[model samples]
Target: MNEILEQALLYDFYGELLTSHQKEIYEQFILEDLSLGEIAGDAGISRQGVHDLIKRCNRTLQGYEDKLHLVEKFLAIKGKLHDINRILDEYEAAGDNAGKLVADIRKISDEIIEEL
Candidate 1:
């Protein structure tokens, strides 16, 4: 993933675990894609202050990911579901012999949710 997306996911999964200042800087940097200067100006601090805040926030976010990995697991499950849905759609469009394949895919998806 791109740095922005990766950082954003870290925040989404672990924002509640972050300090208010860390969350604020992370949200502005990752979600809003604001420049360091912009964030610093908004916070009434120097550009370097914004840069330091982002670095500290990134470390904090990464620490949570290292321990939890929840975001990664969720993404994996979502991707698998999307793949199964695509297969089901294709099978429906193909018709007849693929009916069993669609049934199999649905069964697999059920199993995936059960695993979740």
Candidate 2:
């Protein structure tokens, strides 16, 4: 996965667990795409302070992901859904292969259930 996307996923899954101040700074850095200097200027902190805070937030979010695995499970289920969609599209294009496509959908659905 892309680094930014992974960071966004981690934030989405566990950001509410963070303190409001941490959330604000992290949102500025990651979601708003602000530079450290920019965040520091806005927050009235040193650039190094902004950088360290962002790093700490990253570690904290990653720790949550490590313990919960919500992000991992979400990505897996999303991929499975995408696979099922592709199979459905293929089934539409190959009308004669309806049985096979139905079986594929069933298999993916079972995997999704197991994941949950």
Top-lDDT candidate index: 2
Which parts of model 2 have CA positions greater than 4 angstroms off?
97-116
Off by over 4 Å in 1: 97-116
Encode model 2's per-residue lDDT on 1-116: one tens digit a residue.
Answer: 99999999999999999999999999998999999999999999999999999999999999999999999989887787878777777776687657875777767776776655
- Model 1 reaches what TM-score against the true structure? 0.78
RMSD values, in order shown? 4.0, 4.6
Residue-wise C-alpha lDDT for candidate 1, range 25-110, written one tens digit per residue: 77888888888888988889999888887888889878989998998898899788878888788778877677876888788887
How high is the CA lDDT of each candidate model? Answer: 0.83, 0.89
Specify the highest-TM-score model's number. Answer: 2
The TM-score that candidate 2 achieves is 0.82
Location of the lowest summed lDDT over 10 successive residues in candidate 2 = 107-116
